[model samples]
Target: MTSAPNDLAFLRRLRPLAARELRLALLAGAVAGVMVVLQAWWVATILDRALVGREPLAELVLPFVLLFGIVALRAASTFAAERLGFAAAMRVVPALRRALLGKLGRVGPSGAAALPTGEIVAALSDGVRAVEPFFSRYLPATAQAAMLPVGIFLVVAPLDWLSALVFLVTAPLIPLFMVLIGKGAEALNQRQWLRLQRMSGHFLDAVQGLASIKAFGAGPRMVAEVGATAERYRRDTMAVLRIAFLSSLTLEFFSTVAIAIIAVLIGFRLLWGELDYRAGLFILLLAPEFYGPLRMMGTAYHARMEALGAASRLVALDALPEPVLASGTARPAFGDGIAIRFEDVHLTYPDGRIALRGVTFAIEPGETVAFAGPSGAGKSSIQALLLGFVGPTSGRILIDGHPLETLDPEHWRRHLGFMPQRPKLFAASVRGNIAPGEADPDDSAILRAAERAGVAGVIADLPQGLDTAIGNGGRQLSGGQASRIALARLFCRDAPLALLDEPTAHLDDDSEAMIHAAITQLKGRRTLLVNAHRPASLALAHRIIRIEEGRIAVGQAEPAETACPC
Candidate 1:
């Protein structure tokens, strides 16, 4: 394929996935195209019989019934084509979303952060919806426009070659104008998608930061800024509307001119006794219908352009290289006591922010270590590297004396139970939260873990107890309750290494009692890597390693302010 074809190949790539619906839609459209022809022919015959043939009304019943039947077929085909088109479009959107999300996972967590969360949400939701018109309207319309116009012209040709010649000449003008003008609309549509990305990002930011804005008494100012941005968006939108209107005006002008020229030619021919009234009238009716599909395509044309813009964006997103993942066994045993070491690691984010720089550390077997650092000190980056979300820009991370990259990340993670700073509770019950996504999770063990975490009593008080729905993201639970439940999951999970980050953050006094129990239970059997923010959490670790600006500051096992020992 040439460069032009290659660039837009993403649209073609979706064809097979939606072939079923598109075929149905195409069939409906083709049938509708033929129906319009039959409907027009029957109308012409009925009119000719009544007026020109001077036939009786009673004799016309069958003709009228046939015309109605043809009209009914046209309407049915129209509805079926529309319904099928929409169904195809609906299927593609979610399929696109799933494919995009799967791609995001393969890109890994760090690379996926290249786009803001709000932009991802918008692209997956509204941005994908913008392309809906292509499948639901444009594709079917294009098929109909392609087939119907030719059918009309062929039918019109034998009746009156002069009129067919007029159609032949006029037909190309609609798409011609559409293409020339639509080029501008296509550029505007791509810009519109970007603008939508910005709009969605800012709106999400505003919503998320509303509390801060209110507290700082800057709510009005923020609202004004959002309003100004919205106004700019509105102006951009109106500019697209102006082009559409101009294109519509151009199309209407040409269609009318084409029909007028045909009408004048037919009149002159009829007056000269060369053409019959029935044929002239049939040609008149057929002229608009001939132009009709092309006009429909013209109207639906922008939808195709908009979908193209979306496809272009999707192509760019897919162009991101897949994160290389090691293919290794998932059941790697931890019997040798999993050891972790970071040597001169460095990480620079896609936006050029450096999160890690020459960081070095090591954890021996059965060691309980705490990574003590302030926010943005590359604490999470170390964990991210170990988990293989990303590799170091320069340096290495070793697990069990082997390079971390050589081990399958999923398999490595399967051997470690981690609770990050933010606890994620699902829309399930207390027992469900205690053991999510485990192979054959034990209910009794879940309750035992919950008891150790000091939140089992709280769950027992709920109307449905362990089976009670926690609601989405555990909205029904307090922060302390949520934290305890997460800790419970760590307790119940049978991983050899437990990686817990600030696990006690949102706990109450009562919840802390359970934290102590869970901590004691986690002490010696499993190797523990903890990101601690409090003295109590820090005390659970055998050694404390402080990180500052991606470099190790001090180690509890060594002299104060000593460099990290790799």
Candidate 2:
């Protein structure tokens, strides 16, 4: 992952996606090169006949017409070549984004915990965008560099071997310098790219923590720090530009020298009467076209660096462990209610943190069980396993005597109405937030769910009632109000099984009382698995299961002495 290949695995990986696009682009470039040669021939023939052979203006009409036709063809072919290159880029970008997103989803929350959120976002967005040029410009430039020169060489060699030999010898040197300079630029570009990710991540973190910054009176300091970060990025960008300028200069210098050499050789030969003006003019016109491909290759070598920098991160993202969630084939549906059993379940995260160990428990049909544990005591881990967010490292979770993995995850989730510690609400109307996924949404059902969750009074107080825009993350609502709104979503589901984690957590006394009332409404109507440590919350449970470390205690129900830490 550090190296683009460690050998050429990156190219091998890309071949499948880009092969067809690149082939079409290359074919189009070859055709364009043919047009360039034909246009050069038409122009050279017309000039030779009029200037040297002393042909009348009327006699030159055929050559002039052919030259005009060739010019038009060249213009059309150039347009086609550009369009073909862009089409190839378009083919790969979306596929790459989809595959990356799918892979991240599979990794699950636990698997992705170590990565920075902003960097992941950048990689999926801007990082992916930066690579578009690699396909549209770099790959086509590469194809033209390889194919165009050979076509030009073939035409020139027949007309004049000396000029062709000069082209063949000079073409290799341009790329030689390009490779040597590019080796150094690759590392610099990669370093700058990684730094940009860190800067972006820091900015995102600052935005998310803006409230805390204002409370702590660090807003000005944070702004200054952000400015410093941007300044550093600017420096890195300047360095990249400097290297790019040097690369272009080297290419331009060498190509100019090669063209000058060819023109000099043609002039000497024409003066000695060893070459006809017709053939001499043709070779002279072709000399720059011959090196055109090499110059393009030199420019595109920088694109290679840009792509490799992006690809290194892509490779690293791809190299992460496979997703822990298993997608079972059989469609799952609820009947009555589900009985659950945990058989020797264990959980370990990527950073070697163990969350559960040899734990075992069960709940019969329609039973309401509460798991009480302190922070990091495997309470949430159990919920994660049951919800199909992440699989246990070992052992099995059986639902109604059937292993959970035997059921399709999407179908299994439909039977669940889960309310996590902090349920997310989008920037939508209260009704939309309450009933997000229904194919045909019902206004009455949304209002009913809101009323049942004891939050109808809160929403009714808003300016627009159910039609009010909540703003991003439901920013307009208080903590208790947000919790009540999430509970409303669960009421809307009315699924067979409900998982509520710290349902009243981080809420004011009023909010806690509201959620407690909602829980009172849900009892016996649905099977509930609640994770809590609050005496208020634990008091609502029919049975209490204590979790210490990763294992369940061997005792019966007990009163909550303190909040959490069971």
Candidate 3:
């Protein structure tokens, strides 16, 4: 919409997971840290007791009991944390998806058409999935790692301040190295994701255009395009892998060096007899344990980068601006019928291509109007304006007496039916395709609509009537059949206003006549705007409007012209 904002900032705007789930996760992590510290304390106590006295075999009972309690508590806490984290993650995903979908919905079909289908699919699906690891593993692990090291150090400080200080000072290096290495990794990860989306988009396009490739005998060329896309994706993936490997190695190296330094210092203190056997053993054991959580935390940092990369893309999609609507307004009523007026309406593309320049026209309620012009004469643009797919660059469009901009786009669209130049059909049964999931069109109504569109015969010949399954994109149906099915859907809609974009474009004479009959039947009830190049389709309209070079020529009502020789 406007200027694109920073991705990270956009991502942070998403509401975090539920507070209760986060609280439980943190509580579990705290308990787990305390358990680890207690386990360490019991081990040192057992070692000290056995060294000095002639400890009986039964004397090991208390330490073993403490060990069992520590382990059991730790296990329970781990389980709880995992369960809570997963629950929070699950809750977040749906909200994120809803937000993404809502944003896209607000953008409408014209805005969405600017982006590739594959790219949108990747952002919605794969991008959403990436956040799972961050929530379930990295997030809880980060909390546990932060709490555990501090808790362990507090316990050790009472026994030996010197050892605790050493552990604390060295632990900072692990995260420092991790941050330094991962700084570049986030950028790389973002680039990799972009490449992945592009590759997916290219692949989907190739698949969709497979028939065209076969018809032209250029299947091999299409195959080569797919191969090139795959290879580019592979290269991008390998680059991400290289950076990730280096980051992991750097974190591990720093952790190892820190652990070594702690070990050396403790060994010297014990060798010179400055430290007792019990304290030396306890410090030695606890040193590694303290660093263990830090090491895991460092690893989790890399995972955070990966999640953030995906989140960045998702945030971008969510940040798309919604259409503005006037407040304190009721839905416009079209009792007499819906009349449309364009008062000096101007429309310009984002790239500064003007489609319609100061175009003005008016259509009365229940009138059948046709827009006839050569391609790029803004005929379809006029229909798009009527449908409120795009706001005017300047001027106003009015329905009844109210400005179109003042009306809710969704509410306005609900009263309108449109048939595009190319209609899309989902892979679903005939009834499902016709009515979809939203409209619970009864069998009788569905059959009536199909019959009106002259497609009922085709359905009746099928093995299962309306229950027959259409392949992807209605591949099982011929082009004319698909058009008729789309028309059937439009008929089922039963809107007050109808916008037809070459509704009979590719049909034969008989099929064309059937569609024309359907339009004639709609004449008395619905206001119609038809975009047609053929004379037979135009004959149904009462008025013919001519558009040329982004301007409409206002003239008196005339008999419909059969052909465009202009």
Q: Write candidate 3's Cα lDDT for 21-110 as tens digits.
A: 877898988887777777776787787888755588597997788788888998998799889888877877788788788778767666
Error in Å for residue 425 of model 1: 4.6
- Candidate 1 local lDDT, 166-258, one digit each (tens): 888888999999999999998887777777778888999999888898999998898898898788878878988899999989999999999
Clashing residue pairs in candidate 2 (N, C-alpha, C atoms within 3 angstroms): 374-565
Task: Summarize candidate 2's per-residue lDDT along 1-566 as a digit string, tens digits.
Answer: 28765313663465568778777777778778888988888788888888888899999888788888888877877788788778877877888899889878666676666677877877788777777778888888888888878888887888888998898899899999999999889888888878888898999999999999999999999999999988998998899889999999999999999999999999999999988998898888888888888888788788778878877777767666753445575675666567899999998877888989988888766767788877888999988887776778898889877788777777778888889888889999888888877767788888899999988998989999999999878999988888889999999988878999998888888889989998888877778889987778887777888888988876734533333444
lDDT of the candidates, in the order given? 0.80, 0.82, 0.79
Mark the regions of model 2 whose C-alpha exceeds 4 Å error after superposition: 6-8, 11-15, 18-20, 437-440, 556-566
Ten contiguous residues with the weakest lDDT in model 1: 556-565
Model 1 alpha-carbon drift over 4 Å, by segment:
1-7, 309-322, 326-346, 354-366, 372-377, 394-414, 425-433, 436-443, 461-480, 504-516, 533-535, 543-566
Ranking by TM-score: 2, 3, 1
Best candidate (score: TM-score): 2
In what order do the candidates fall by lDDT, top score first? 2, 1, 3
Candidate closest to the true structure, highest lDDT: 2
Give residue 209's lDDT in candidate 3 (0 to 100).
84
